[model samples]
Target: MRGKKLADLNVMERIAQEDDMGTMTKDESAQFKADRQAAQAKYGQMSAEEKAAVRKAAQQKRLSDLNTMERVGQENDMRRYMSY
Candidate 1:
């Protein structure tokens, strides 16, 4: 379990693994803790529609970022080929 890759676990399992590991990095762990606490505090005040909108926006941003990364990767590959 100690040496297991995160890719091998499902979401819940990966969360469990992270919890078991306890310290990902001091700064990261503290930031995550703060973020979770903030989200939890804010979530209770949000309406259902607001939560849905936030989720949708987050998903769209994630997809947009992924597409941008793919395009950049393709451009880098082309540049490498041209240079060679």
Candidate 2:
């Protein structure tokens, strides 16, 4: 696995790639920090109810995007969990 290219990784291996912080490139880290700051600024401007609504809407959209197997896995509390 040490010498394997990203394209050669399996589905679970590809998914696990996100768990390795060293995998992030400098540009990706900068972009992620920028995005997070923007989201934090936006959230800080929202009221309590507005925040709840926004979170609910995002959850709904995420659930809708999942396929049957993923949804079923979620319902069953599988090892592979979805994140927001």
Candidate 3:
């Protein structure tokens, strides 16, 4: 895994890349901080209904992404088992 490129990593591998704070690179941490600040700024100006909508949309997107990641993980597992 040390010499592998990001493109070569499967979904699970990519996700595991940021498993903990100690594993996160400085650039990744900076980008994550910037993104969070931007999201907070955007949310701060929204009306009540707009905030609710945004929250709901965020939840849905999170769930969808998790489902997709899970499916990819399952596919990877199946492939590994099939090679046995």
TM-score of each: 0.43, 0.52, 0.42
Residue 21 alpha-carbon offset, candidate 3, angstroms: 9.6
What count of clashes does model 1 give?
A: 0
List candidate 2 stretches off by more than 4 Å: 1-28, 76-84
Question: Model-by-model lDDT, in order?
Answer: 0.72, 0.81, 0.76
Q: Candidate order by lDDT, highest to lowest?
A: 2, 3, 1
Residue 1 of model 3 has an lDDT of 88
The candidate 2 region of ten consecutive residues with least summed lDDT is: 75-84
Compared with the true structure, model 1 gives a TM-score of 0.43
Order of models, best TM-score first: 2, 1, 3
Separate clash counts for every candidate? 0, 0, 0
lDDT of 2 by residue, 1-84 (tens): 779999999998888986855688999999999999999999999999898788777777877899998888777553233342
Tens-digit lDDT string for candidate 3 (1-84)? 879999999899999997875678899999999999998998898999897777667655654666666867766554543342
Off by over 4 Å in 3: 1-22, 59-84
Best by lDDT: 2
- Please list the residue runs of candidate 1 whose C-alpha ends up more than 4 Å from where it truly belongs after superposition: 1-31, 68-84
